[model samples]
Target: MDFHHVSVLLQESVEALNIKPDGIYADGTLGGGGHSYRICERLGNNGKLIGIDQDSNAIAAAAQRLKEYESKVIFVNDNFANIKSILDKVEMNAIDGAIMDLGVSSHQLDEGQRGFSYQHDAPLDMRMDRRNTLTAKSIVNEYSEEEIRKIIFEYGEEKWAKRIANFIVQHRQTAPIETTGELVEIIKRAVPAGARRDGPHPAKRTFQAIRIAVNDELGILETAIRDFVDVLKVGGRLAIITFHSLEDRIVKQTYNSLSSGCECPPQFPICICNKKPIVKLVNRKPRLPSEQELEENPRARSSKLRVLEKL
Candidate 1:
């Protein structure tokens, strides 16, 4: 499948950056260069954009899409979690702005062979970066039922996680669950028919849980957000678009932590810890996509764009 991802909240995120004509910027999740293209368009000749993505395919596609601004663009095929080190390597101490859109690309789900979608019957390999050895197959086949249940319950927020884990274990005992189809079937069998009838696809939550586990999606997030904040120049903005509640919660809490001041107790007469706010929330609440944007792309339905400016 072609590397294609419709940028969610494109205009809102770019505008939130408050882009300077000659300022340096970073598109931390430069999928297909959707946001980067707009950023590059607004940049003067002296302006620069550091486009980063863990997926090599995304980097390549983004490169082609932003070819006109090649002189202004620097592509890095690395995870945004490594933002600090990446900036260090590039010898950039600070960036004017940055954006992170945390959502799986359309290509990943559409391309059945990549195994990100339960609707597709393919080998269970959901590694966002192919270089990583860990895949959905290993998690499904090797993880203990308790561990699986915890992931499904906590990460997926699926109420039937226990039964799903039980079914997976039972089926794998006969033969290792090698494909998404097998896992989907196991999930369908595990979830009661009446329960499945009401909500999304029977296997959606379990599949989401397995994919998250395989990539450790939530593990590096908090640190990554802090790292991104650490690299922003004063007055620089960081806009993040989170697709699900889990990601949005982390982003919100991290922003709150970074932008909060003095943790001293209310009864304290004087300040002690000296904790000062590092950033200010650009918007008290996250910005949602407009009705037009949602109509154009339903995948962005859950996206919430939160922005913060460095103090």
Candidate 2:
């Protein structure tokens, strides 16, 4: 399948970066090179872009898409969580700006063989990086019921997590749940008919929860955000687009913490804590997709774009 993804908030995110003609920038989630392409357009010959992605497929696809600007682009097949090390390897001291689009690409969800979608009946493997040993199958068949329940409840925020976990445990006892279709069926059985009658597909939440657990998505987010900030120049900006509440919450809280100046109580007359804010929020509230963009790509409806600049 062709590596295709409708880059959410393309204009908004690039604009938020405030690209400099001679500045260095990074696209931390370079899916199909969509945002990177826009960023490159605003850069002069002296400017450079580091495009990073954990998925080799994404790297390959982006390379082809961005071939015209090869001289201005450096592609890295690695997770954005290791931004500090990645910058060191590339001999880049700091970046002028960076953007992270946290949504899974349309290609990943549409490709049945990759197992990223509940609509696809494929092996339960959701590793964004194929090199990872952990797979959704392992989590589904191996994790304790309590562990499964916790992930669904905390990550997915699915209210029927307990029942879903119970159903999975029962189904696996008879035979290992091996495919997305089988898991979907199990979820359908677990959620009450009335509850399943409305809202999202019965399996959506469980699939999201399992994918997150498999990739340790939320676990690495806060640290990665801090790392991105650490590698940013004094006035550099970081723009992140999150597709779900869990990710948005982390980004908001981390940005808030980093942008806060003092921790001393208000009662103190003189300043005791020497703590200072490292960045300032560019937008007090996240930027949502425009109505036109939403009409073109409903998948972007949940996405929220938050930007910050280093102090």
Best by lDDT, which number?
2
> Where does candidate 1 stray beyond 4 Å?
none
Candidate 2: stretches off by over 4 Å: none
All candidates: TM-score: 0.98, 0.99
Model 1 vs. true fold: TM: 0.98
**lDDT per residue (tens digit) for residues 1-311 in model 2:** 38999999999999999899999999999988999999999999999999999999999999999998999999999999999999999999899999999957888898788888999899999889999999999998999999999999998899999999999999999999999999999999999999999999989988899889888999999999999999999899999999999999999999999999879999999778988999999999999999999999999999999999999
lDDT of 1 by residue, 1-311 (tens): 27878888999999999999999999988888999999999999999999999988889888889999999999998999999889998888899999998868887888789899988899999988999999998888898999999999998999999999998888889999899888888888999999989978988888888788888888989999998888889999999999889989999999999999999999999999899999999999889999999899999899999999999
Question: Candidate 2 clashing pairs?
Answer: none
Colliding pairs, model 1:
none
State the displacement of the C-alpha of residue 255, model 1, in Å, after optimal TM-score superposition.
0.6
